[model samples]
Target: MQETIKKIFTENIQVQIAAGEVLPSALESAAFTIAQSLINGNKLLCCGTPSCHMLAQHMAGLLINFYETERPCLPAVALAQEQVNLGAIANNDEHETFARQIRAFAQQGDLLLAIAVNGNEKQIISAVEAALTRDMKVIVLVGDDGGELVGLLGPNDVEIRVPSKRPSRIVESHLVNLHCLSELIDLTLFPQEEN
Candidate 1:
């Protein structure tokens, strides 16, 4: 049992290290894009499904609250956080829950961070389309060759693909990526702070 646990941790760490090597440039670009959007008074809209949904909310909370720092709150919203709205949209439109939220809240110059381990979920694709229609820049955190979501990204958009097919490792890598991104945004926005 101890060996199994250690192996799991080792594999996760290995995947995360590989992801760090491959995804830093994309992550840096995403951080810069998010920082510029915030500096311009634009908000960040994040969305995902299941495990990714938790990550989306975590990222939003980190941005809107703080990430290892004492700074003013930044503007960010997790599209999946509103259960009532999501349930209503799911009941009514079935496939347009995230799309509806993106259409309603996202604006030009805003940023959309979409996290998907499989990267082919219908609602996330719909949200991507809606964000594009609103002229929002998109940063996708995906795994497993980026799946179909990679095809949806434009030249100006960014995709951070974790180089692993295992969903658990991919999700773990996503969490690390999210933390790195949040820290990058914090440092970029609040450079003078000692924290």
Candidate 2:
């Protein structure tokens, strides 16, 4: 059991190191986008699959509540958290669930944060398209070479592709990145606060 624990930590560290090399610029970009949206009085919308959905909600909660400091709550919503809306959409057009929610909630200049491990899911792609149609900025955290999600990104959109193919490694890296982004957003919005 001890060996297994150590092995997990070692592998996680390796993946995180690789992600550190490739993801900083993208993370910075995402933070800037999120901050700018908030500055402009725009909200953030987040969505993903079940596993990634938790991360999406986690980020929205951090922004809408507080990260590590006592600051004003930023506007953020996790589309996946709308149980009734999701169920209604699922009953009608399942693949369009997120896309429909995005259309209803997102406005121009708002930011959409989409999390995906494989990045090829149909609903994720549709959500990206919907965000684009609504003139919202998009930040996608994806794994395994970004899958089809890479092809859908526009020039202004940002994609943070985790370097590993394994889902566990990808998710671990995403959590770290999400926390880093929250800290950055907090600092960028309230630089006067003591660190």
Candidate 3:
């Protein structure tokens, strides 16, 4: 048992470091793009699964709290349907509701950050296409297998690909990488002020 526990911890740390190596560049690019978009006067809309949406929400919180950017806080507008509780109305919407909210939230200089694990969902792809057509800047953070999502992105879009093959560690690694990104964005966005 002692040996097993020691091996587990060792393996876990190694896996995290390896995953980090694959993630930092993408995360940096995504965070920089987001910070730039907000600095240039763009509201942001993030959409993804419940777990990934939680990540997006946390990212938004970090942006507001640490970056001090005057950006709008709009989260997974499309996934906000099916609310058993009125309090959950804010983040639970169906497809049409998401579309409607997205259309209203997006503008010429605004941005849409789409988060996906598989990147092959029809609804998500469609939403991404719609956002792109409207000329909003797009930033996609998807797992490496999310090739389908990549096809929809244009030159202005930034893509962050995280290698999440291990189901057991994907969520944990993703959260760590994302939190690092949030911290970096905070540092990068506020360097001048900090100086």
lDDT against the true structure, per candidate, is 0.88, 0.89, 0.65
In the range 1-195, model 3's lDDT, one tens digit per residue, is 999899877766776877777766777787787677767767677666555767666666655554344533423223343333334553554443444556656787777777667677555676688787788877776764766889888787877766655443555666676677666766665554643
Q: Please, what are the lDDT tens digits per residue for candidate 1 over residues 143-190?
A: 998878899999999999999999999998899899999999988989
For residue 109, model 2's alpha carbon misses the true position, in angstroms, by 1.0
Model 3 segments more than 4 A misplaced: 1-15, 67-93, 192-195
Clashes of each: 0, 0, 7
TM-score of 1: 0.93
lDDT for model 2 comes to 0.89
lDDT at position 140, candidate 2: 96
